[model samples]
Target: MIEFRNVYAGYGGGDVLQGLDLKVEDGSITCIVGPNGAGKSTVLRVLSGLIHPRVGEVRLGGAAIHDKSPAAVLAAGIAQVPQHNALFGNLTVHDNMLLGGYILRRNRRAVRRRVDELAEIFPTVAERAHEKALNLSGGQRRIVEFARALMTGPSVLVLDEPTLGLDPKTCQAVFETTKKINSLGTTILMVEQNVRFGLKLASHGVVMERGRALLAEPADDLLRRPDMGAMFFGHGIEDPTAAPQIATASTDSSGA
Candidate 1:
């Protein structure tokens, strides 16, 4: 489990995540959704040790991990897929996967074995193992990142915008891959722009606004409450019966 207590962090001038308190339960998928620039990505950065929290504390399981280095955080069993496809376009898919194992250089044979195992689960990576990463589609690239993240054998996975620019079909593909990763016992902490799709699969749902948690509700109950759209999206959608468009949007987003 991951816990944040009055956690505050930002870059340069100000705090984007202001006194944020969050909990990611063990063996569950927690999805954070909110408007653009609501400090969604900042949470991932703080936890991944990419950005240091100015105040408060962050803990992985029971240990205080605030202000740790990125490598140190990964060594503590955390892997993060940043918002954009942070891949080297010129490198072959296999090489990209190898880069994730720098922390495991001593276990070369084990890394090779794990890469093979992951390729079996994600055929796209296997089929294009020798191809340049730039050639794959956005969705396929996302899965490769997932495979690469697992090379370190981390128990916690932090994902920032797993699906952003893909078509509907491709989004479905990425979603399925996320499910497979979580099934392997890697706890998932994700920030998504597309609310309904991600939340539907989430065991826990968090709503953030202006760098603060507006609400935390079970995914199912949140979806059924029409006020969710109005509160989060700034639309006056109070009742499902009165608004078919809102109903369809909410229902479709819930992955139903």
Candidate 2:
């Protein structure tokens, strides 16, 4: 499990995440949903070691990992797909994935073997190995990022607003892709702005406001509860319109 025990982290002066105490279970998808500037991405950054907590502990399976280097975080089996695409638009897809293996023995033989194995799991990476990353669509680019993150063989995958900027069809596609990844056994922790989409894709749900956690529960329960709706979507708090239309999203993978 990955946890934040009283985590307090921020930018130059002010703390965005204040006293965050949370946990993500192994092999489960946990979604953190909140409004703008609620420090959703900040939580992922701290977990991945891009930002260290100003105070308190960040632990993985009970060992303190706060303030470790990004390389150290990767070695500890954590990989992050940032809010942005985070791919090298200038490089070929194959090279971008190879970079994820930076902490590994980068001898050509080892890199090639790992790449081939990942390509089997994520066919797009293999099919477009020679193509520049810029040529892919938003959903396809997100898949490439997932493929790249897998090169590290991380135990935990952290993604930030992964479906942002996509059309409804694309959003559904991305959610399905996340399910397929979880089935492969990596634990997932993410911040998603698509409130309904986020909760539906996850087994566990975390709600935050003003940089503090407000609620954590089984995702389907969160969907059925009135307060959970109020917290995520504000007072109007409308449930998914025509949910029958969007119900095709697979929540079967969500085993709380």
Candidate 3:
């Protein structure tokens, strides 16, 4: 399980995540939803080791990893796929997958074997093996990103808005692939913009406001809550323009 206890973190300007607490069970798809500046993605960054918390503890399976480097986190079996493309546009799809396992450079044979295994699971990887990532559609590129993240055979996969810019059909495809990945035994922690869709796919749900987790429960229960839409998106049937109730001072309303 991944747990955060009273975590506090932010960019140089100020704190974004303030006294946040969360838990992600092993072998489950936990989806986090919130308004624009609720520190949703910031939570993922902390888990992935891109940033460290100023105060609090981040533990995976009861072990502290709060101060580990990004590479260290990856080696510890957490792979993160950012909101934007992290792929090398000019590189072949196959090369990108190989790069995901760069830490395993000494074992060329194992890397190749893992690539082949993932290609079988994600047919798009094999189909676009020789193509440049830039040439694929948004949906295809996202699939390749997932395929690449799995190259390291991580125990946990962190995804930030996996279906952000895809067409309806492609969006469904991506979610389906995510489920397939989970079936293969990797825990998934994701932040999503489409609240309803994300909750439907998740086994657990987390609702955040201004860096603090206000709700945590089974996804079905959270989806059934009458105030869910209002709580996360700052809009309900009656108050369409109501501002999201923030719990902190910083208002960097970009990602997370």
TM-score of each: 0.88, 0.87, 0.90
**Residue lDDT tens for model 2, 63-93:** 9899798889888899888866689998999
Q: How far is candidate 2 from the true structure (C-alpha RMSD, Å)?
A: 6.4
- Residue-level lDDT tens digits of model 1 in 77-134: 9998887768889999998988877655747777778888999999987999999999
Report the error of model 3 at residue 232, Å.
3.0
The positional error of residue 40 in candidate 2, measured at the CA in angstroms, is 1.0
Cα misplacement distance, residue 229 of candidate 3 (Å): 2.1
lDDT score of residue 177 within candidate 1: 91
Give the per-residue lDDT digits (tens) of candidate 3, residues 4-72. Answer: 878899999578999877778899999998888989989999999989999998999999999999988
lDDT, model 2, position 105 = 56
TM-score of 3: 0.90
Worst 10 residues of 1 by lDDT: 247-256
Q: What is candidate 1's CA lDDT for residue 56?
A: 84
Tell me, by lDDT, which candidate is best.
3
Error of 1 at 34 (Å): 1.2
The per-prediction tally of clashing pairs is 1, 0, 0
